[model samples]
Target: MSSSTVSRNSLEADQQWLLRSSSPENDLDRDERPSKPRRHIVAVLCLVLMFTVAGYVTSSVLLNNRLEHPFRIPKLPHEEPCDFAPSRPSWNSMPRHRRHAFISAVQRLASKPSRLGLSNTSMYDDFVYVHTKVVWQVHHHAISLPFHRYFVHIFEQALQNDGGYDGLMPYWDWTQDSSDPLASIVWDPWAGFGSAGNGCISDGVFARVGKFANYTENGYEPHCVTRNCLAHADAVDESDGVMHSKHWTPAIVKAIIDDSTTYRDFRQRLEEGPHKHLHAYGIGGDMASASSPNGQFIPQPKHTLSRIP
Candidate 1:
């Protein structure tokens, strides 16, 4: 054969051999292979969705049981016996030393290392994390009151155990100050949750004191815990120190309680009505946000207010 014809034939043979020897992946392209990342993302998404659904179902069942039997917590034999005798007094009724100690405990807890998650955070910040995280799930539902009650109890235990507080779980009885919420002893600069703020508080125990959680895109960032005691939506109450106290008069709260014909109704009304106003109008800042509990720098007032009964 001629040299030109022979070279063309050899090139064709080499091309065929190369194609035959290559694997299917090499024939197509390595980049065209199925994406492991996409599969992993799908698996992770499925797991997240499964856990979320399970959590919701479990929460619903537990909340329903809580509704049916509000005080049916299972206790160990060695656990402290239930005592109904110790009266849960209002914040106003607590003595100076008790209030001071409780405040100290709260501060100590806030200052301590995180017990819930992330060693970088404080134990109190853990409360803020869960409170902010589950606000949507627990609030505006049957679990609202019960969940908060349990949360407060756990917080109180933490205070006693970690903070060395040996006093009753304090709470703010808003009814006393509902007519003039600002003047309520809970805001006492010397002994209470410190003074109010237009933006961030500038005076009192928590003055310029930063918190580990502040409702940011990044879950935990140390910032000043806010208490906007002057913020109000009502044009009339906009500048009033009492804020929207008119809507929360003792009679108004009584009516809210009395008018609620069903448990759900009562819960819904209380959650959406005075409970909301007290946080939004009565005290603004973080309380107005999804994480209402983090609004106060001084949790003693928040704790005191949380103990409804």
Candidate 2:
């Protein structure tokens, strides 16, 4: 061992030690390095959350829109080809005579076939037979108001039987209510219907109002006719507030009676009559008549206007 050889060997050994230590540390550092894959995963989660929020916002908007408007019901496929057929054209499409016939029929159905006060008849018309208990309770002794659904159905059926309704069955929803006591637009408010040939008209407000007697007495009161009945129930002549004779005056009774021929004449005249301003101040729109509920106006030559004698 020369001194130069010993120095060379020492330098080589030191180099080897340094290389081993550096290699291990470099390997560990590489092994501990973070991957880009984890970042991509975080990005995906954030996107999902955003979409979920967007979906919720969209749903809320749709729900609000639905609440504001009338929901459009989806139409189902018709059972028959003509099941969805449009009914005959509205009032204008009807022939003059056919219109008259339809009107006459309506009157007959509205008025009982026979009675003692208006005209003499052997039969006592049973108005409550077709009525529901709810309606009967309201109008037992009173005149029955026609039911809306029943009236519309019967009116449509009669019109079809006559080859088609010459005129549309006019509608009149009583617009008055307790919440809106002063609101009497009286949109063509001659009338609308129930079980009776003439509708149940005790105090003329309808079952919803209960009975007028209930006002004075606390509990449910038996129904009774009142002079304060709805204006339509009182008289077509708007001038007369509500004329009352214990028995209605024969002349007025005759005027109100709705038999076959007379009914036809009455409706024709009414439709033809000048739609006088129901209110003095406001310009009046066209005056329209409402159909009797359940009972229809069907033309019958022999039919009389009233059950009265």
Candidate 3:
């Protein structure tokens, strides 16, 4: 109750004091824990974050150079008065009967341009006349190819004589690329503006004369050429106006089929009649220059010859 009791009581008091000081009860205990950032450091971090965001936004803006749209180039126009040296024997140089026959034949073509052949069909009559005229003029040495202007005039006349044209004549729309410079002829039905050929290169009849016999204008043209003239179509099918030599009229073929004897005799007479004249009067090259292993006759020659300025 004296010395021992007093010593025990002092030890208990010292233990309690040590526990309270070490158990987060003193300021020194708080100092031992991690401290929060200073306001200045927080402000500096916020400023750096803001600057980084602003820089990203600025970089994004710079990367996208504002342009409304893309750029494009244009094409050039075509040259006129198509380049072709006129051959001998002016279209008018022929006798009146001969000229009338040729003219009549061409005029007739406009009315029945499409013809029955064994495997294909030709263009409609008016188009046929114009196209054939061009081909013949180019290939036939005794004929001169017409300029584009006179060709147009003859075309107009042909149409008028056939009871006036309601629409424009179909033209070879050579705007697109040509597969062969020497043997290619392109035509678009909707190539002209307004009335029939409006916005299209077709006028209900157009034939793609090449390795592929396609009718882009009307699916009927190729049929006519193929069905009636199988032999002629096959031999000179690939050739343009300058290559085809043999031309068979529907009447002739029909007559031949009807009566072989009469047909043969008539064909023989027809051949012999014009054989010498054509052979002797060509531009020094005979029909050979106009010949193609696989070709059609050159068209529009008389049109060229009619209006030589």
lDDT of each: 0.56, 0.26, 0.27
* Residue runs of model 2 more than 4 Å from their true location after superposition: 1-102, 110-128, 132-151, 159-165, 173-309
In terms of TM-score, the best-performing candidate is 1
Q: For residues 47-155, what per-residue lDDT tens digits would candidate 1 score against the true structure? A: 2222232122244443343322222342222347666645555778788888888778878877877644455766666667666555444455555566566566666
The TM-score, computed over Cα atoms with residue i paired to residue i, of candidate 1 is: 0.68
Clashing pairs in 1: 170-304, 171-304, 171-305, 172-304, 172-305
Give the per-residue lDDT of model 3 (tens digit) for 135-220: 32222121112223433444444443442333333322111112221222211122211111111112213223222122322222
Cα displacement (Å) at residue 265, model 2: 42
lDDT for each residue of candidate 2 in 1-309, tens digit (9 for 90 to 100) = 764454344333333433432344322222222234533332332222222211212434443434221112113233466656333322223344554555454444333332212222111111211122222121111111212232234435443433243554432111112122123222111222111112233222232334211111112223321211233222324443321121222343345444426433443222122111111101100011111112222111001111122
The candidate that wins on lDDT is: 1
Backbone clashes in model 2: 34
Query: Which wins on lDDT, candidate 2 or candidate 3?
Result: 3
- In order of lDDT, best first, we have 1, 3, 2
